[model samples]
Target: MKKYALATLISPFLFFLFTNCNKDKSNTEETPVKDTIVVKIDSVEKKPITTIDTVDYNQRMIALSNNDTTGRWPVKAPYPLPGALLPYNRIIAFYGNLYSKRMGVLGEYPKAEMIEKLQEEVAKWQAADSSVTTIPALHYIAVSAQAAPGKANRHNMRMPFKQIDTLLSWAKPINALVFLDIQVGHSTVKEEVSQLEDYLALPNVHLGIDPEFSMKNGEIPGKKIGTMSADDINDAIDILVRIVREKKLAPKILVVHRFTQGMLTNYKAIKTTPEVQIVMDMDGFGSQVLKRSTYLRYIYKEPVQFTGFKLFYKNDNWNDWKMYTPEQLLEFTPKPSYIQFQ
Candidate 1:
């Protein structure tokens, strides 16, 4: 959200209420960089990675809760079918759209520089908590909400398949995961997710839906904060379930971003299936206090299956304010399982 960076000039109270909206025009003319090379990991024979330890699942879950006595930290949800990632590995993702540098770190730096930065973050998180492994990820905004209505009269633009292919390539060399984030505007979640069936079928590819730009009431995106009902979230879960089952693939991770209470309604009704793991991400940028308050108010209080936190390099570091370090974030009531950088 561009407005997040302007908080210093405005009232702190008012700034906290504004949604992070990206209204930049989609740059479709740029072609994928075929020569881009991600860092190569050492080629040594290693034990096959286990997504979860069945016998110690509960123990791992408790460890992830970070001694939360609130009873809401380790959500009482069904154990995801084998090959799940949550509660086992903390995902460190860089979020943004390749078309807009202002969107996030994903597009702000050069491919090589961005990957290097993400690797450094992964290492920091690993060092902060050695209990859980850290997995680097690229959270790309595949479907972006637009300021202008397109041919479909929906204020959303879907990036071409080639762009997604490029992101997949970037993940290969580093052994990282990929998350395709969607920001629907004047469109439905089902409509947007259905279009990505091909990509979601892949084991390494996951999903993220942003209710901040949902625009369910037909309001133009970026003018106001939007919302997504439990049904909207369930729609996404349903799609991922079908993909996992039909393809006989591992469970997929679904991330939903929220900074305010209204952004996601009927939280209790959001279903968690064995084929899909849901992460309720606190997607806001501000002082460390404000960010923690927002997480507690919405994510921690709501009792989602898993939790995620986003860091804004420029927004959180504004006016002499420092961003939250991985060690500090680990002190959170229920340590975030997913960490995103914008």
Candidate 2:
């Protein structure tokens, strides 16, 4: 894990159905609405104790085994959005903050230099799997964290629209997608997401929610790893669904970052919709062994519609750290369609 300038800014340790465009909401599976979830405010007692249904260990092993007759756990089924970029191919993203140098490769190098480095990475994946069309992306943190609170009294700082537009411009020449990530701090996902509606309306722009910095209980981000309940996750989904339907555009991709079990709760209750494709990314970095363990622990056990694996160039080196090659990662039961490097 790369450290953030604000100790609280460090990213903390951190799904879907198919339906026709004309499908009726009444006919689809009904998940609990916001009222059902006890939104924890200040204390654990204030937050209702929600129980997550656990999958048996043996079942998880089976899910990880590629012994199924159908073969391949169905590649990105139904495609998250109508004109989607992922699942059909592999998405390789370079994540970081342009304002901070320590965040990722995107910021560590100059613009021309960063694009060159990203193109180099894109080349490696293109060679590794010529069959899969590779798409490059800029994973920008649009809403950053602050050591001291701003006027909102929330430790979050939002980037100006022009700044985001500038970064989006950089991705155009390379034909890359833009992922506008949000770390809500004391704010709610819905509140943070609403502000990015303009960006989300675009086909190439997607969304990422960082639970580590969510700080659901008003604590500053990066202090202690924070958590997001299923209800909170649903808020983002609803926003995307409305945008996709109203704009009459393609489906949107929502990437949720997770490392520990507590980072995200009430996994089973998450709703799936055809308009919004959700990806649960294994955001932890470590030795190959540790990475594999974390992936199996949460990703395998609590399965989502699609899966993603993240690689940290500097941080993963923490423990005898040798990064896993693309071929090595593809060896998993259901190969992850989304891959991110920071």
Candidate 3:
């Protein structure tokens, strides 16, 4: 009688415990994680991404590093890109604004010889397989202050609109790239870049930011210029990319000169504009005390193209241009993109 009574009393407790367990499970909430998807603003669809496609930026890097059949670095773009300009290479040259002038007598190599020389360089590049190819030399025209005194000093600073036209005429036939360097003024970044809208319209034309003359707010360049702010540079490059895209021009390169970190105070703001190239030119003018070390440090730390070099033509060494040739410049662990001769 006692055992039966105990069992009857515990039945209510057991039933309550079972009811509480079911209630707890019913109240619980759970949700599975969704995969990351890029919503193409236009399509508004969720496209699945494979693991390799989503994560292997490194693989893409390896492919780009590998040389093409011509032993040249191919850019991430449509193949057979116009001009034999290697997408990535150690040395892209700097041709003078009026490098090939058919001055005085009839003609030696015809004004087109400079173009021919560029072609020859490309031929040499094609001979090698997966070897380091040299990018075609680039000619930069300085229109503002903070220009290099000896190399692109005040005297030779501005390339008149007419001279620029001649260069474009020659460049088009050979498919050469040109950079129009500018020193920021009191005007905003957009305002300054706006001035060169016509030039920027061309496929080969691009902009270069010379920190040497980039001014602080209200300060004049060349005299007491201040460091460039990150936002100012970022906005400038962003606008340049938009222009290139809307115009259907080749990918424009935004070149920034930096000898030290202070030169570009806000580097993080530099955005990766689609199809636009970002090159950080380490323009160390003086003797290369740390040229090798700095090139290794900076190039590895930031994978941007490195440029600029001083030659005998430099104000300090113009008389000795012959002493240091292109071969000598290539001695750097990774060669320079271009050498700036005075």
lDDT of each: 0.79, 0.69, 0.45
Give the 10-residue window scoring lowest on summed lDDT in candidate 2: 14-23
Q: Summarize candidate 3's per-residue lDDT along 216-245 as a digit string, tens digits.
A: 554434333247766877877677767866
> Which wins on lDDT, candidate 1 or candidate 3?
1
lDDT measured at residue 207 in model 1 versus the true structure, 0 to 100: 99
What is the lDDT for 310 in model 1? 87
Q: Is candidate 2 or candidate 3 better by TM-score?
A: 2
Q: Could you give candidate 2's per-residue lDDT for residues 1-342 as a string of tens digits?
A: 444322112242220011121123212222123232221111111122232122332243244344544433432233244454444457788887766666677777889998988888778888887755777889987776554455666667776566577777787778777899987878889998988887787767889988877776777566677799899999999999999999876668899988778888998778788688788888866668767877777776787667888988876665577888888987875667678888
RMSD of 2: 14.3
- Winner on lDDT between 2 and 3 is 2
> How many angstroms is residue 11 displaced in model 1 relative to the true structure, after the best TM-score fit?
14
How well is each residue in 1-342 modelled by candidate 1, as lDDT tens digits?
345332211111111121233333342222234333232232111233345566688988888788988788688888877667777789999988776667788988999999999999999999989998898999998887776676777777787777788898888888889899888888899998988887887778899999888897788787677899999999999999999999887789999998877889999999988899999888877777777878888888898798898888887898777899998989887888999998
After superposition on all C-alphas, the RMSD of every candidate to the true structure, in Å, is: 5.3, 14.3, 27.8
Which stretches of candidate 3 lie above 4 Å from their native place?
1-91, 95-135, 146-160, 217-220, 224-226, 293-342
Return the TM-score for candidate 2, rounded to 2 decimals. 0.78
Q: Model 2's lDDT to the true fold?
A: 0.69
The top-ranked prediction according to lDDT is 1
